[model samples]
Target: MKNRNIDFSMVLALTVHDMKNSLGMLLNSLDELRMENENTFDDSSKFNTLQYEAERIHNDLVQLLGIYRLGENNLSAHVEEHFVPDFLSEHLARHTPLLKGLDIECSIVAEDINGFFDADLLTGVLNNTINNAIRYTKTRIRLTANEQDGYLVIGVEDDGEGYPEHMQHSGTLSFKSLDFNTGSTSLGLLFVSAVADLHCEGERTGHIKLHNGGPLGGGVFELWLP
Candidate 1:
């Protein structure tokens, strides 16, 4: 005649929300410091690196939370048509300061096409992709979207040396096969892979892939969604 009720999902959500808010406050403080002391650090500023690291942490937290919710069957895509160019533009804006600090040129190429996907989830993957590009790019990076072979393909490219041969794969990676020695990308790749697989339609399943060489002759992070 006794009832014990514990809402684990709500508890998880509240905890994650609190961490997200704290991270936001810290990021804002770091941004203010950068603005007020722009010239305080030399070209080799550790503070700039700190900012990038913070961004990476923020991205990881977001994607981790998304993947957890998705795995628990508590999340669903709100797929919609988005103007490809505007989407790329908004993504680029978020990393503008970092790109500028690194003297990297970022651009987008789209063919007046609209992409059908969940913008919130897709942005998490794009954040990782673009941030990686910004880190490795020699001087330029590009984002492009187009419909290909009955699926919408979005790609992020950089002008630096491409991924190592071991890390370059043709399709979505299995969790057991990911390489941990490949710098900080292992987790990001896994997160993106989960998000990609979450999108599906009929006989087609979404996927993420890696390759060398493209418009930038460097690394490319490609995501395909149906």
Candidate 2:
């Protein structure tokens, strides 16, 4: 008899892919339910909780798949030019329902400018960041984008208790340093960092910055793309 070895990473990727698809279907159903009971669901905390949790899980699965691809060197930014304000507005629109249900006032403040970067990758990064902001924001969240020092700076600011001092830093974060046991794995940051690093122009590559104090007076997450 011969023994065969199994590829655990492959198995995990396949499982996560399946889970992501299933969650997509679940989200669609949730959206349908919300539409059917629009008046009641908007004011129902339980419905809001269900939508929030489902969206969070969907985002997690997306990040996991992205991380897996990064490890395999199969992920790269497909940079393209995009109108900043319109891009930000469309992304925020997807979460309007959930944001309204939570009574969180979300808005975009991007200037009239064009950015050159992978839209899909940026969407993934923003999806996770916005969801995190929704989780902690008291009553307001702002999405802003503008050019600074020859780089495009996109920020997510929330009026929640700012990021802990330990997480406040600049540069691309390493997944190796993440502590899963702490309940704050910072996995989203890792994925964001990976996406940011993929954008490059000349000697400048992208990176992420975490700090406190913005228009929101809370955590500010900025992605700098060159």
Q: Pick the candidate with the highest lDDT.
A: 2
Candidates' lDDT values, in order? 0.81, 0.93
Candidate closest to the true structure, highest TM-score? 2
lDDT of 2 by residue, 1-226 (tens): 7777889999999999999999989988988888898999999999999989999999999999999999999999998999999999998988998898889999888889999999999999999999999998999999999999999999999999999999998998888889988998988889999999999999899999999999889999999999
Off by over 4 Å in 2: none
Q: List the residue pairs that clash in candidate 1.
A: none
Model 1 spans > 4 angstroms off: 1-16, 32-44, 179-185
TM-score of each: 0.85, 0.97
Error of 1 at 190 (Å): 1.5
Whole-structure CA lDDT of model 2: 0.93
